[model samples]
Target chain A: MAETTRASDPGTGTATPDAHTAPLSEFDRDTAVRRRARGEFETVIADGWSVFGAVNGGYLKAMVGRAVAETLPHPHPATVTAHYLTAPRPGPAVIRVETVREGRTLSTATASLTQTDPDGTEVERLRVLATHTDLTAGPDEVRTTAEMPDIPAYEDCVGMDLAPPEFLRDAPIVHRLAGRLDPDCVGWAVGVPSGRAGTRGWFAFADGRPVDPLALLMVGDALPPSVFDLGLSGWVPTIELTTHVRALPAPGPLRVALTTRNLAGGLLEEDGEVWDSAGRLVAQSRQLARAPRG
Target chain B: MAETTRASDPGTGTATPDAHTAPLSEFDRDTAVRRRARGEFETVIADGWSVFGAVNGGYLKAMVGRAVAETLPHPHPATVTAHYLTAPRPGPAVIRVETVREGRTLSTATASLTQTDPDGTEVERLRVLATHTDLTAGPDEVRTTAEMPDIPAYEDCVGMDLAPPEFLRDAPIVHRLAGRLDPDCVGWAVGVPSGRAGTRGWFAFADGRPVDPLALLMVGDALPPSVFDLGLSGWVPTIELTTHVRALPAPGPLRVALTTRNLAGGLLEEDGEVWDSAGRLVAQSRQLARAPRG
Candidate 1:
């Protein structure tokens, strides 16, 4: 009972990729993005693949959204932008794709993810820029003027246990939080606060797999930064990111919200939303970080 | 009277790039992103440089942040990510720069902006991924748990005059609305709208130019989108865009909101906020549009 999987457990949501609880070979060896054979599309970044150590810009933007969803024929991923040039180390990474407008319905690619050196020479790090479509028809015209924050019903919030390391302590992303968070962002990230700058609850992954759209594009930088509740902390990284899926997420436990109003100078801006336990409003995100240096 | 230039008229905040207000040689020839002599940094996608007619992913991420602020020695542009790959049609758009991860303090570049097909072959359209720092120090720590959205002060908003042709009705950015918006996304958008989406006020640049951080990166896609208040209209392009500058905005009228919760399938997600009329909170954006098709 991953906490009794809720929102009435619609469709029983099954992600079907269990090598042993959603390992799907680290999403096909380090997050879904493929195309290596010396043709730009690699991933190995495994050495903790961190969050406070660096290597979690949504798991390298799901390795550039599975390398722009394998050069898009169309499976859905409408947008994904990542630009975190520095802080990237674990090992073996190369994702140099670039199609830029593939169209049928819609497609666009640009994957960089470098850092191969050893005379193999690569060294870039983050530059995912994407867009792929086929959102299952759905929009002739739909409407929503922004409204999905009224939380407190993921069985009534509050439940978090994050530690990262036991080989990522079973990483795929599975935060239940909502006792109002921001103890310096998931610092034993407890929960229960929606006063405003943000935090809403429940998200699934550690093998409970379900949400898709490239794992909701790694759940939009996977939380912990609503600018650490204004006091400012360390390892804030994440230099650039953009995600927008809009629909195709409705399984179990997805309702997330991680907001931020703004932070200047050292620059910080964050915003996110993901509603799915049948609530709809699938994905939306915002990023730009820098704080925790000197 | 530029409508009394508000927020109690702070320092008369005028960016002075006049040729009749921030003409700025069209941002050094098509949006502040220079470096061309056939070396490889270019910009020419003009012919109305659209917003609904296409070609405005923040003016191609300010032409990849003026070509990564001319290969980063740092003049500022800490982050700018654009990923639109379609709707490109107005000519000579080349911006191929890639200096990923350069750091003395911070620098990351990756401009692709192509579209050179006559016979030579290039075709890329958009992919500006940047981060260049040295924003003149001054950040050891700052605090602002997010708060700045109580707008409607800029002379009380509502003063728009859009035409979209007088060579894009003089576009170098200039909008003023807060008389409560959605007039059809800054309206004068002319006709059709009964749905509901978003819109907010006060933004400047029509040579008013006094909001730097690269013009707050073109005021995060310079308005006219909230999906035309859901009645749904054309030119909602913007395939992907990410901007986050945060603070440096202080001159005059700056307090924008522009929201959109979700618009599913045809896919839409817009979120923007810029508040600096001495109010603080400077640049934050989100884009992933596509709702003008059928």
Candidate 2:
């Protein structure tokens, strides 16, 4: 529930709250609550049902990263394999974490999310595998074929007036974290901040919204055509999505580079990396999606 | 490879020399491996690929499982998610287990398998997420939708007219683990005796050749049509496979029950569960596949 205070206390139409704010920044609000708890783990069940509306992809991705941060060991980073069970509607849900085993160097926990229904069945389950390390030499021969595209910056590219539907007006989480998108700005995400080894990167929405990792993962499969120089209108729907998050960035700009290794008649596979401003590879995503018709 | 003794040699065709010397009963093989490794942890890669086969799913699954097991603390059960990056061929591979973090009750480990290639471009990366556990309580409404199906015994199911494939006959590793399958067998599996908590059932080819889990995963999805009375002519190819191994079952006489949910507009989704004769749930698998016209 949200407070009913807006600029339009009376009748000025111009002072009215934005329609998209009906469920404005619930995750941000929730985090504000959790921050007060000294960063201990918390759970809020998703109780209502509605389309995610205009939340940007990157913001959703950040949500997932936040989820991982909430459950993983503090200070030590984690690599998580997340599978989207279904699109969640804005509501409340409870997340439970059970520490499986704890060792000197490594630990494991299982997080299960059960959606509250009158019938009471678990709708989704997430298993995260995290490793703790002080520091070590990483993998060698790290090569990626994704070349950064020449897109405009956030400031110069705004106000091109390419808007979508009402429900989707500025709701995507990606745009919020990366920064306001200028029309000239291509949907490129860089890795996370500096001093981070392994992978870290920045990601934002083409249309601005808050950045959430879950959204990026939800739409990471949508990059084959864009990565392969094909139009988004031509690709098939994604059947499965699998993302590997090595580490989180220090919070900054995001650049995404996509490359296609195999694309046949109807089936296609693409790999993408999310980079932050500091050029650390924050996250990597791979998916098997259907290639839409040209 | 196996030593070829003459059929006329006493106790040759019936069982192997070890079996002749210490006559392994059906239960002996079932419980032998399980008893040997309980409470204590074994360094699977310490022996370094001594017992393995090229391209078999069972060998791959077990090898991967053992890799994860080595990283776990003594006597902790492990549940692993092995993602197949590429098809493994015959050869030597190394399984490295690193402790992530150890705690009082639970612990975790990161296990990876790297196959050395002659070309050496990209070594096939098999990553396993493993964990160990202690006491846990779960008296909730425990129910599984994976219903058992009616099938003939493993011996009755094998046709006398159909000679088993040469690969099934010749592989030493396969011959050692052949009792794992029965005619009334629920599904194709390859597994060695765990000699610990329970049996570990897996998928294997008839030719004593170890089958890949992906291939067995395909069967898990395909059989639902037959099990659910869809009356389809041929097996359907899987479009998506999602599997979760809740617990390990012993290596022999595993039962699998597949239920088809729908076959509409060329797409199908099947739900399945594998159980032992003791009526315990060992594994759960679900698949989304395209039903081709038989």
Candidate 3:
């Protein structure tokens, strides 16, 4: 099964090596891979998580997510909002956490990710505000309400086409985007504007690691801006993004729905939902980004 | 106009005192109403903003928004996320900011709002991660794309009925809710479940203060959880909410569109778009809140 999903690495332009051959346990092992001492959490971003030049925001989020989650009694991160301060290069980073109110039902905490400068000043990297809670025990109001949209199976969606930017093309992950009748990224990928908005797709690591909560964040925003389909172009940068982890996804290619409801006042808002293959909604994210210029 | 709008104070239930007597500029006056010393941004959350017990989240947000925006070269609070740590009784609060990265075009900063107890130990109150940018100079891709759903004019919409909760009712704000042939939070008011899920309204302060960007934040989340209409009942506490200030809202009763896209595993996500009376998309917000339970 992995063989069929196997393909050359577009970002590296290399015969996609079985670099994904690492065990699936690495998802948990790598994301929580941190050490704490003297009021700070520190971690080395292991290999294979870069999108283009910087580390994937989702993976970075997982690092802080775990660090902060550990500070609270709740085992599940109900809400986590990470503010990218300075995107640090994949490397040794420091996370300092402040516990706000450690309630029995819910715990709210904040973490700051930083790296030391050569001059020894702690360079701040990211600020994360998270609420951790025991999902099953939360106020006892559980229901699966929004039915998953009837999206075609992973095999039905198109494999990533004309790669996003040169940077995102080389990621060490695999993606299966939804097939769209409209043109994709023509303004940037091609020379003309496709003049539509929205991009949907499924994603999994090349090595077949099932997506955990952290990876879902990465995969959720990792898609090309839906605006690209609209024929608008440029780097559509994420100004602020908030993700709600609905449930730890069940294994397999994660199916996702992505769209921009409005492109106004020089900004576009992307609304994305991630559904596990089991058809359960796993996570939902909304990001505010600048619309790419024509 | 003030006499006409200044009819009742729902949340306070006071004989609508001269309290609503202050000009709407007081919202701005009370929010940015700050003092900075020793690298701390401080302000008093004046009276009149709380819905029931604590200050409204949107009002709290504007306080931080103004303080942080004042610290940045860009005066606009482009993106701001506030995680309620522990609700502080309206009083003096201190905001300590950490400059994330002050780019020429955009500046990212994080602030921790704290209030000192009688013991003198500062209690961490709220965490706000904000991006400040010059709204007018923002990428310049200005284009109004999404059309506001045509609805009755402000006067045509019924004045708020079936007040949201005992807490939101009797507040100084006056709400002109869009009358729904479908059931509303009236169930909560009448001790019955409405068995539907949706709420839309027009709102402005009782003193005739037009909604500003800061006030818009409050009004955006002010409506009863569309969930109440769904028959689920309990406090739908906001876990985390992110709002984009697409453009400074024009003065008038802001039209807000609110709905939860999905309610899975005890969590529901509310997507809200706030359009000015002029029908321009001024802001959009998505929040993760607990599903209301009976």
What lDDT score is found at residue A35 in candidate 1?
Answer: 70
lDDT measured at residue B11 in model 2 versus the true structure, 0 to 100? 12
lDDT of 1 by residue, B1-294 (tens): 244442124335454555664435333445644566533675676654453345556756776677677777777876677776655777777777877677777777777777767798777766677777876674745556656777655555544443446523544233221222423344425555545566767666433446578767767677667666665666677777777776566666677777776676767777787887676767777777776663
Best by lDDT: 3
Per-candidate TM-score, chain A: 0.32, 0.54, 0.77
- Tens digits of per-residue lDDT, candidate 1, A125-158, equal 7777677888886554566766676776654444
Model 3 agreement with the true structure over B198-267: per-residue lDDT tens digits = 5666555554455655565565577667777676665676766677888876655677777775676677
Measured with C-alpha atoms, the lDDT of residue B70 in candidate 1 is 73
Could you give the candidate ranking by TM-score, starting with the highest?
3, 2, 1
Candidate fnat values, all: 0.77, 0.01, 0.59
What's the lDDT for all of these models?
Answer: 0.63, 0.37, 0.65
Comparing 1 and 3 by DockQ, which wins?
Answer: 3
Query: Please, what are the lDDT tens digits per residue for candidate 2 over residues B1-294?
Result: 222321112111222226556544321222121112322222222221112232433334455554444445533332334443444555456555656545453455545556667887545444554444431321222223334445445444432113246534433333333233223332222223211111122222222222222223322432213321333433454332344433333334445555553343344445455654445554444443445464
**Residue B210 lDDT, candidate 3, scale 0-100:** 54
State which docking tier applies to candidate 1. acceptable
Q: For residues A168-209, what per-residue lDDT tens digits would candidate 2 score against the true structure?
A: 243333222322332322332222112111111223433233
The TM-score of candidate 2 is 0.41
**CA lDDT, candidate 1, residue B177:** 19
> Which lDDT value does model 1 have at A149?
63
Q: Cα lDDT of model 3 overall?
A: 0.65
